[model samples]
Target chain A: MTEPAVTGTGTGTRAAPKLVLDNVVKDFSTRRRKTVRAIDGIDIEVGDGEIVCLVGASGCGKSTLLNIVAGLEQPTSGRVTIDGETIVGPGPDRGMVFQSYSLYPWRTVSENVAFGLECIGMPRKDRAERVQELLGIIGLARFADNHPKELSGGMRQRVAIARALAPEPDILLLDEPFGALDAQTRRAMQEFLLLVWQRTRATILFVTHDIEEAILLATRIYVLSSHPGRIVEEITVPFGANRGPSVLRDPRFLDLRDEIQELLTTQVER
Target chain B: MTDTSLQPVPGSGPRTRSGTGASNLGDDPAAPWRRTAKSGSRGRKQGVLFRLRDEIPLRHRILLAVIGVASIFVFWLLAATLWSSGNVLVPTPLAAWKAFIDYWQSGELSTDLWASLVRVAEGYALSMAVGIVLGVAIGSFRSVEAFWESPIGFLRYIPATALTPLFLLWLGIDETPKIALIIAGTVFYNILMIADVTRAVPRELITASYTLGASRLRVLTRVILPHSLPGIIDVGRINLAAAWLMLVVAELLAAQNGLGYRLVQLQRFHQVDGMFAILLIFAVIGICSDLALRGLRTLVAPWARP
Candidate 1:
């Protein structure tokens, strides 16, 4: 899984990153009026064409952080800026995928993929062309007319991905997009996501509890510690977009995985 | 050298003829009438009645139900003539059937059935129109729910029949009172049921749409409405029976040309057989309406099937 040469984000290139989550903090109030800080002091920068993953255990509020970036939930403090502009609310610039798939059951696969386009009032002929193009990318062209309920869990997620990509967002915020899938499907989805990222080169911030998943997909992995979640470390992966699942067998991958595993246990003990 | 086939595309993506393995099951719902037309004379060879007998429990159940129905008729025939005075109390099944045929021949049955059906159609349509609008509005918005929910919940406890006399006074002895009574009977229940349906729509779907760049109005119209529609249709079918039940009660109060009116008039003249005929007619109408609603549910929302 090696390429002849790489030009972007190598030792040479130092271009401005696409997304900056600067000292983001989020607070939540329980039913009993107890104030709880879900996320504290999270700082992340995602380069253009990069996939960044937030890996944490339960109660670390990785999903909450992802939601804030999506603008579904606002951060209690600090600002999230993309390309030097602060984000106030959800816009077409950032696309999102959820673990639940959340593909509209009433719509067919293509119809669901066309939803974002339809929201922006894209013309019928252009929308149809884009829909066909997306269905092909997801390998669901034959099942274009099939509703979400008729599809398997993996197929549904693929449709969700296509719909998110339809608007061609600058950043994709995925909240455990493959969390609900079985191990086999999750692996396939991870590989498929890499290919999609190579093709689109959109910056992405993904959240997951699985450490191995973060290693497989992310350009850089952010290890989040639990109990008032904060980024423990940022490990820049040496792997490139040319790599696939074959990279899992590499000695470097095992070393990184073990290193992160040790840090996780040690932090949890403290 | 860089792999050329796996090339970068800044504009329109290259057509790689996706090799992604996705199963395709195209629309293939069975249509019986098409087979009949296509087969022509051959259709008789595999007649609808006999062709699927091996697959269906209906053929065997039909004979069992026929025997059960015949036995009831025989018991009625025997019991009605058991004693000289018993005939006055229990009318023979033959006499009831004969009464039906007589009323049908005299055109009285048609007029009564038509009147009741018209009233039900008008009143039921009105309830559905208002109930759906108010239900979706109230269920989706907290402010709307707060304004209307308390009164709707309170009104559901009062039986619509109890308001028949009030409706009669307000509307006089016309079809208006009859229709209004049926509307009053079913509307409140429908409002609550349809509201429950709207509330039941999953919150994840809404958030997903919002993140997909849909506006607030788009979420309501495209997401919430369509997601809750199948359940709303189911609620409507359930409430249609309530509408029919109310029609009978309302007709008993003032309707001069309905089946309920015919039943009352028949009893006044001690025509027990004709009264029994009207009851059987009501049962038949109820069964037909239920079948119709089930068919409509399938046609409108095949995706809702388990």
Candidate 2:
């Protein structure tokens, strides 16, 4: 692993990488003893407060890369670091939002938000106050007493997001967050996520297979290639001043989308 | 509509006694008398019988009761008719009831019932402790599972009572042998049940805990144990009945005060009614044990019940 080049002095406060992946590789063995390389020699550095989206089609190792950073899985080689320190395991610094809305079924919405805090042995009063704050911010104050099973799909995802954000993690890792929802719900969630990011300014590594979603939300998009996934392209989009869903209609955005589509289609065919 | 206006013809509101040309019978002190008057004219109603019919859910309870009652009545009727025709194998219902009550009063029934319950409690506790520990060990490790797989499978297939002679030889014809027999019969079933269920726990849940900075020991303690508890309690319910069956079988071979021994003694004395009484006790014990185990399972593993 090479040290990331030290660039200009970071503006204002303390310095941190936020998240870094150094030459991470992963290989999975099926029952027949055949090995498939899921991620190969991936290295990337995401700065504090940066929203980096990993965009790719199916089996391109987008999810596998995110799982490695979340500490849900170990890479076959290399290391992942956060805040200039090697990540030993998952901690309160990096909170994960799974695509399945994996809210604890036995717990109410408020209790689900309190799970991470409880695991850290936070004081009861503080835990309750934090949960209340998150529920209010997520616009689920009225549904706090209900279990996950009783909520609609969109509402459940909100609760899941609230649960992941309850501990105030510096980095939020969302794995295809709105992938499980209907199109209308997906758009609603996308707007909700932008609102949340604006409010907290948390660094996010969002993984999605949808090109439009990446173009809509991401500050910079990293495109991944299939068949032993490696970075094929990195595009920096210029959203002049106003950044929102309307940015998708920009001519430059469409041109970039077409180029990425051609690149991804070529990789898939190969 | 005309029907809406005609709906209030009899009484509009609470009636007052000051005579507003309204039916004031409700406010009158003679209301009870009027109610009784209607009842008398309508023929006396069987309120108690009606309430009784409504209190119990007839579809379920009545069906069960009818089957039970019919079987007992038919058995007794057949016994009576057979005896009258000079066949004396089975006693009549009245005769059995008389003998059952008399024998119960002799203090022998209470002693045997107490003895059997105590033995079951002791043997079951021991077997549960051994079964859960071994089951968890085997279920958690692939190496341990592989080593014991064949031997345990073979042992489980062999009836535990077949080892009764060996237990008797080793522990003598005492309470120890009988209790040993009971434990042997039950522990194998519990081990296999617990291990099988424990092994089926979702691998994702375990991996999730581990990735959340939980150590291997912590993962086992916090995730695996809680997840497997419902399965363990389920197996416990099944093994409770098995333990009782083994206990009665064990006691049937010994010389002591147990329900099974009492039945055997009554058989020797040609006390067919007394034997039937002991058999009834056995049936009651089995049903009560099953119900008690089910209640315990529901209480401890509430999440298992949806």
Which candidate wins on DockQ? 1
Query: What does TM-score give for chain A of every model?
Result: 0.94, 0.90
- Deviation of model 2 at A235, angstroms: 3.0
In model 2 chain A, the worst 10-residue window by lDDT is A1-10
Query: How high is the lDDT of residue A213 in model 1?
Result: 84
Candidate 1 CAPRI level: acceptable
In terms of TM-score, the best-performing candidate is: 1
Q: What stretches of model 2 exceed 4 Å from their correct place? A: A1-16, A237-260, B1-100, B141-151
- In candidate 1, the residue pairs with backbone N, CA or C atoms under 3 Å apart (3 or more residues apart, or in different chains) clash, namely none
**Candidate 1: segments with Cα more than 4 A from true spot:** A1-15, B1-88
